[model samples]
Target: MKKNYVVMDGNTAAAYSAYAFTEVAAIYPITPSSPMAEKVDEWSAKGKKNLFGSTVDVIQMQSEAGAAGTCHGSLQAGALTTTFTSSQGLMLMIPAMYAMGGQFLPSVMHIASRVVTSNHHSIFGDHTDFMTCRMTGYAMLMSSCPQEAMDLAAVAHLSAISGRYAFMHCFDGFRTSHEMQRIEALDYEDLRGLVDQEALQAFRRQSLNPEHPTNRGNNVNPDIYFQCKEGANVKANSLPDTVQHYMDEINKLTGRDYKLFNYYGAPDAEEVIVVMCSASETVKETVDYLNAQGRKVGMVQIHLYRPFSVSHFAAAIPATCKRIAVLDRNKETGSVGEPVYLDVVTALNQAGRGDIRVVGGRYGLSSKDTTPGQIVAVYDNLEKDEPKNNFTIGINDDVTFTSLDYKEIELPHPGQISCKLWGLGGDGTVGANKNAISTIGFVGGKYAQAYFSYDTMKSGGLTQSHLRFGDEPIRSTYLVSSADFVACHAPTYVSKYDLTEDLKEGGTFLLNCPWT
Candidate 1:
């Protein structure tokens, strides 16, 4: 007895989770993830059938490197392939993502992430095309909205068909792919019983067979080609414990708690921030309004970014965290930093915590606007004892500078909730706030979050949706400093800006004006 549904964004929950277990997708389109390959080509031109019923071969390529060479020849012809893109079409699928991770090929790409134009051209949202596909070995994850982008795109297509490896499953393009909400529609018999049906039938009984003839794309002529590329890097580092045992069996059938990096504020917090996509729901509402004013602050977010756990991010940074920032929406010009602040300073110097200081910044990127008073000015410059070393957030650097001053703070309201939208640039108000965050995460069961701010020249661009519906699991991050409800679909931006500063004192403002 479970029938709840509602979707409208995060590109229709990534084309309804790639029309569930897609047999072959391979699409190509850009901008805020080209309406998820135009809703999987209008649900494969209205045929729509999955849950093992089949009928999903939506092809249509000719770009994003010919949809990553038709998802590497439809996963070497055995099928179960997928695709969708963003930002320079995920940088033109980096050499077919290093030949689908040197032939481990288990495919999954979805990625609404945008903003990879550099110094100018932008389509919004950012992470520089999934941080330039972390060395192209694939396995990146990130998602902060649209029911964790349809339960992590069904846990990266059931852990890429039982851990063969190749996934990207991102989010945050036009704020969770055109915002819309109301969820609880994933249980195609519990995602076809979380894959591994005898290891996807022994990977289709070891494919590429013409009555069992082998030999695939080989050319290793360097005497055991570096021992077959270090045995394909020990099978891509044992696929992060086979993707954490299918993310602990889908967190024991959806009790919600996916790991590979997922901690949020206050559990013995001191001052943490590290981030990932969808602006970690505005830094979890500023870590529930600075832990309701007591202020210890905490946050981690980051979901499996190319197997970079480092002991699960140094055991979710606690040992009385002594100030860290990391942020990064992508910008790595002269290197030494950028990939999530050099993997949180190499996982806090390999956990020795080297007196934990860490600092690295650059924010919102092509999509700009990172508010909550610029995350309370990066937690007031980590309560400065001598802060500045490397920073920039939201902008205004006094004519050619490092940026850091946007201060005018006055935020603290844990039970805070806000919503604001001023449509125009393709007015769907980010697809009706991703359908109100899947109807407040399925009829207000709560723990729903959304944050969006656009307008860096994308034609009449000016959008904002920063929502929060509580009952635990919120953890404030940034933007919507105090809202509580504010919607204004362009009544000329309530006479140009200051749309009631940070509301709260009595909150609730919804304006789509017409009373001319």
Candidate 2:
């Protein structure tokens, strides 16, 4: 079977999948997530057809709140609706999210998960934005990279339609959202083939039209409101199976295995790390490196976060797992452990796996790179008789002494060529690297990955481009700590930054400077 491979970023991949299933898109521009809506709008303008055989009606709203309202109204009128947002933009949609979910509308919101501005504002990626919505009656699904963003996005839509639940399909902002990679493209035919048409028509028949004449959203007293809220227990309980069914369909089409909880590394691993979002990619890479070195380690990557299935969590863990580290990407202040950690503990206790020692660690808050080095520290921590609980990684927590000691280590990728470039923000370095990755993947017939890191400053901020390509697939999700080639596009960076600190010995160095 031949595949149609395309070079694209997570945003484009999400938009491509969303466009196939969406009939109406209510959009509000937000960093990282904006590209998804922009792509959908662009495609609709070009007269692209969805599975419904018509162009999607794209509406640009004044704010995320308005966009969500528009999405809710569209879904009520029997249109399959979608919206793209992140950060505070997602927060503004909470009121509407509850309404849609309660009505059992199958609206898929594509979220490029970003840092929810706490004391300070940041436009970077993190899980705080979406994790805050865990109680909002939506089934959450996360993708670690561009390919999963494309594939799982379809599962989110199909499951939402079939299960009659709202779905938030989230990918790490900037990390997965902007990183360019080559992936198998899913055509509209694939989505149409997988979608349950009868379920979709059933949804349409329940629309708020004169022909339907249904009553909804009536003000209720405490007597029935409590019972009404609890009535969704059956639907919520069945969501895991619904999501898995679609995931299996996608596996059949793409030949890539996906589960609610996907495990990687040794089957009889003694130590395990459970994590979600883009950080899972880094953990998986580290697990492979450790297992090759004869260490019994493994990782469990979460897909469907909401409607937390304890059975699936227990089934994913190996019997030999003596210690488990649950890593959360977001920090919940004043809480004993972050969301994922708490869930893992609950799942273990509920599943009668309380014998396994479970430790919780926080990493990648506000998009901090969760490197192989940090992952190693987690495994090392697990080795201790009394491992550190509620610990931190990837940063020096001098005040609290909760950070694990980690040495910088790079995972080996055979035949892979790594390159790093430093430039000023708005200097077009990121654009150039994106184009380069596309060329390498498409023209050069190589698998490539590119990630751009920069500060919150709109312009004149420091920026770095990490690029890698090889004959084989690239799974290195963290920043390139060791590069075969290093380049400094801004002359000032040569003096301020340690440009060649990680450059490989006998490697090429390119300097862009005025003075010879």
Candidate 3:
């Protein structure tokens, strides 16, 4: 465990983790999530062997639903199956999810959750697509970054076999999915321990076989249907505990504590913020800052968002907490609050801590920036006599006036050397940075992270790559606001975007143009 750093995006990390557990992969390409499926396909083509000592059978399907159906069929036939998808693609998998849930098939689906298409057809990051799958009976586990995406992805697949339930191990679409980072990878051999040999054998026995001659997918009458369905409650109810058991096993291997809910802050924190995914990492920096200044602020990160354990969530909060702000990534426009916020309200009521005030706020809709400053505003509001209950950040909503006014804040740039590269889509900027970070992170024993953003015009769009290198873990979840260096990877970009926008006062600007 000294160093097994892999410089890759969350999508690649998740895909790599799933590759170790999967026997068959039903694949289809969609933005943000496509790289995950593509990686599986490439590995299988290269004759990569899984834990079962065989190359995974990766089949490209016609659509997301077709992929889901193929996974369902494969799982029913005793093949450990998985798939990667997002946004509309995820919606297409819903019908199959219902069936997979009923049979309690151990299938794992890796998702880079995206904004559900409303009036806008944006290909940005959000939890809207995932929020829709709450009732799908899949064990929903979220990864806060590329590292967690890999770590928790293993947890998802292991839980698939342990709990006999489908999994949607999700990360922010295009945010974590495409963001590359330095992370210690889970050795497949170490991961092999989380695999329950007994469970796998039992799962195989349950598979449909002509030799055994068992009936499945039979239509039961209303008289007997309810009783038959209720029978599954035993396993369904035990799933959360089953998931935590695997988490405990992983903790032993990785030495990183993961739980249903994780808390970070002063032990006696009073102002609490509840949230998950990439923003939770950003909030932790803010929490660290506030705590350093002798302020009592904390954050409770929800990892196992499904099963909605009221007791577990409430236990993570400090007893001194009086005001709680639930920051949700996706919005519920017509509803009283965002999904996590409302869920927190319900959980508090169920935990019988109604005296503790909990409010929900929305941030990072369509990958909108969630900075340390905006989070500071939430903590600032928590101390007020009356905090703005339903709020939005990273925007000035002067018309409706739901936004909070906070100082422009950038993360405390430690020893990290940050850089930005502006390029056209056709340029090799992203690929170059990927290699650069890997070389630096893997060779220099330094931690590095990279993130890319581009327009919808696939090949000809504007592209920006953000790169950071440091001796410590990279915790700035947001993009490079003030880089120490800026480079224009394409000359055309020089006339388009502000390539030197946030370069430090004495920062270097290198234009990758012939004339320069």
Q: Of the candidates shown, which would achieve the greatest TM-score relative to the real structure? A: 2
Using lDDT, rank the candidates from best to worst: 2, 3, 1
- After TM-score superposition, the amount by which residue 167's alpha carbon in candidate 2 deviates from its true location, in angstroms, is 0.1
lDDT of 1 at 102: 70
Clashes of each: 31, 0, 0
- The segments of candidate 3 whose C-alpha lies over 4 angstroms from its true place after superposition are 228-230
What TM-score does prediction 1 earn?
0.34
- The collision pairs in model 3 are none
Choose 1 or 2, whichever is better by TM-score: 2
Candidates 1 and 3 compared by lDDT, better number: 3
Question: For all the candidates, what are their Cα RMSDs to the real structure?
Answer: 19.2, 1.1, 1.5
Residue 475, model 1: lDDT of: 38
Question: How much is the lDDT of residue 334 in candidate 3?
Answer: 94
Clashes of 1: 31
Clashes of 3: 0
Which sequence of candidate numbers ranks them by TM-score, best first? 2, 3, 1
Q: Global lDDT of each model?
A: 0.76, 0.92, 0.88
* Residue 66 Cα positional deviation in candidate 2, in Å, after optimal superposition: 0.4
Better of 1 and 2 by lDDT: 2
My TM-score estimates for the predictions, one after another, are 0.34, 0.98, 0.97
| Ten-residue region with minimum lDDT total, candidate 1 | 471-480
